[model samples]
Target: MMKLSMLCCPLLLALPLLAQAIDAGPASPQQQETEGWLLLQSRNLAASPQPQTATPTERELALQRWLKKYRYEIPDFYDPDAGGKVEVKK
Candidate 1:
């Protein structure tokens, strides 16, 4: 009984590690944001490769507004207009 318990203990401890080993592959930006708080759980239900468009959360929207208004002279990704596609409506 002691031997059986020891063997089972190792298998149980390894179970979560084995789960993490499965290839989730690459995740897209949209898939990274989700209704669930955890991205990992959401990614499991997400259709891979193709990304679904996700609406920005309130906090994200606020951050974008702040960056656009107070970015000073810094350029590139921090400057939304650098992409020539960001249209932030006032």
Candidate 2:
């Protein structure tokens, strides 16, 4: 019938698009965050690397002093058992 053919024609054309939309739904928050970090890292890597210096610059020294004076100590509690237990020497 012409009506059945017309109805199926539009649906056949749209089925693939509907399937794509369902399959490629919105990215998860963590996936989006990881993608953002990956983009940032790629940009940083693409830039020319700065030369390392034996001595700190005045700006670096000043920043270090400020951090030493005001920065709160970050607790080092991440992956405490990562490498298994270490034997302590007396």
Candidate 3:
């Protein structure tokens, strides 16, 4: 019983590493499509500013609104050129 338990422990420890290896494949077509969509949305949001006198909070709010609108198809990272870290809320 003790020998069997020791053997199983090694197998268990290797399982997670094996799983990670399998997960590390090239991006699929679907992933590419989604990333493209996110880049577009981020760019659009960054380009269009709020009203001339809008406060920083308002601008961030506006961006968040757009993000929520496109959350489903958008990736976590947006295009930097569109606007990187313009108004990040803690």
Clash counts per candidate, in order, are 0, 0, 0
Please identify which of the two predictions, 2 or 3, would achieve the higher TM-score against the true structure.
3
On lDDT, the stronger of 1 and 2 is 2
Regions more than 4 Å wrong, model 3: 21-31, 45-90
The candidate that wins on lDDT is 3
Q: What lDDT is reached at residue 74 by model 1? A: 53
TM-score of model 3 (CA atoms): 0.36
How displaced is residue 14 in candidate 3, in Å? Answer: 1.1
lDDT of 1 by residue, 1-90 (tens): 999999999999999888756457446666555434366566675456787665679779878988897767655557555567767999
Q: Which digits, one per residue and each the tens of the lDDT, describe model 3 over residues 16-90? A: 888644465337989878887788898775455655588999999999998887756765888778655578789
Q: Per-candidate TM vs. native? A: 0.24, 0.29, 0.36
Q: Which stretches of candidate 2 lie over 4 Å from their true place?
A: 1-7, 16-26, 45-90
Residue 70 miss distance in model 1 (angstroms): 43
Q: Per-residue CA lDDT of candidate 2, range 1-90, in tens?
A: 999999999999998888644456337988878887788888886454777555568778878888896676666787766669889999
- Model 1's TM-score against the true structure: 0.24
Weakest ten-residue segment in model 3 by summed lDDT = 18-27
